[model samples]
Target: MPIQNPLKKGSRDPYVTIAQQQLIALGYGLPRFGADGELGDETLFAYGTFLVSQGLRAPTDERPKSITPAGTAALDKAFAALAQGGSTANIIDERHNHPHSGRSVSMPYRPWPKITAVVLHQTATKIGEKPASWHGVPIHFGITRAGKIIQLYDLTEVCNHANGLNRPSVGIEIDGWYAGIEGRPETLWQPKNLSTPRQPMNFPTAQAEAAMTIVQWIVNAVAANGGRVTHIHPHRQSSKDRQSDPGSLIWQTVGLWAQNTLGLSDGGAAFTVGNGRTIPEAWDARYTGNRY
Candidate 1:
């Protein structure tokens, strides 16, 4: 059913739920409140953001009070494109411009063994959206704050991002500094000597959605190449020093959501690949350890 026009805040129409679901599917996260059929603040904010993303609205404009006809059409078009694998249109391939240093001198690019997982990370500082900003970065994908997905390396090449999981996993670097645990003071794991003071940043809905889309893209690409991506991990799971690599908010919004929605796994609560720490209990309640 098409979303009813003028679906403003406080509206509890079924169409409102439909819009919410579409927004969530596109990566405008309603973390606090889900698609509950109520056009509340969270949903409205997500809707406005979506409108802004599609150039239907301006950033300086106030959050849209009602879902206009144009917004509804734009939402439907985007959703249809996503269903038809149009999400790849959002990716900017910079692999040719910025290649990774291959794993060995003998072979410039080592073929990936069998990609089974994706490790997520945060830059711990702002990273620009241009290809020049990601030069020499080891990660396969880098998502900027504005939700641009930049491919820095080919999936077939074994680029070193995670310690032990490089060969079997792909890496996604979400651009921003986020706290390991939200609302907590940053002590260790805080980037040092920055020209400006570092503050905790929230994962924008678009960036989070880009991360989700890329994860699905990886799963599809790997399957096409005779491999299956079965797990989604945080960089912290592969390096003890990266206790806050991507942080809890991101894990809950993107990682845990992937496991629940996309049928992916996090290697269980106690599962840790290398000499790194476990996915902290704060990130996932299944892990009964306090090691964060």
Candidate 2:
């Protein structure tokens, strides 16, 4: 059962009211009639589930219904596990984040606010890339080589990563150079932070784990937001040969997680909205049809 808005307190909205109900039926009660889609007692049941999944004791905290950042990670961990057709984990791995962030707003897709897809990208620039935007990181979330998932801002706010296609998408940037072997069009340009023995520039275990968890959370959030985006694409696919980010390892790793585990549409496919693909075509051409 996916954790909808009412699944946690102070959340935005709840789409799968039954997700909460299932928790309650399964002894993870948030509150009866939790489908009301508002934060209330039922949130505690979900929170407790989060704690239990994290391998922690039941909450004795003053406001047990309250969800800390850690609590959200636990919940996301559980969701990711279940989404992939696996049982809930006894614990969710930890995720790192940036301290500052911008305001969040739902994609409210042009025709209507909705979840069209989860778009992926690479920093292209350093993690702390120069010529920074006053708005914050262009990508909604970033995964560091150390497995840190930095939340630059709420998913609701738009960033520069996806270019014109930002309206119906949720963009994520993973650390390290996602550009392929030949690299980007810029001949002089090169990845500033390539890891050791790096050929594919793979994601570290911690980052990979956190990414899997977060992608699940993002998918659910999109479902809650009206279900417009269901697939995952590379950043380059969203632009006119202008960008090529979120390299193969990310596609193979996170894309497989979305498809095999979550049973989502092919993240490597060239899903077009207007002129852009949901992601890049380069890596997708190779990784598509093959399990990562």
Q: For this target, which candidate reaches the highest lDDT against the unseen true structure?
A: 1
TM-score of each: 0.70, 0.50
**Ten residues in sequence with the least summed lDDT for candidate 2:** 87-96
State the weakest 10-residue window (summed lDDT) of model 1: 102-111
**lDDT (0 to 1) per candidate:** 0.76, 0.51
Q: How many residue pairs clash in each candidate?
A: 0, 21
Q: Tens digit of lDDT per residue, candidate 2, span 1-292?
A: 2332323465544323323422432345443543344555556656565576567655454346554555544544554554353323122222223333332344332432555667777665546422132225655676666655555555565545675557656777766655342233232225458464233343455666656767777776666666645666666566655344565556655664576456667543435544654443334433345321
Q: So what's the TM-score on candidate 1?
A: 0.70
Candidate 1 Cα errors over 4 Å, as ranges: 1-89, 102-113, 193-197
List of clashing residue pairs for candidate 1: none
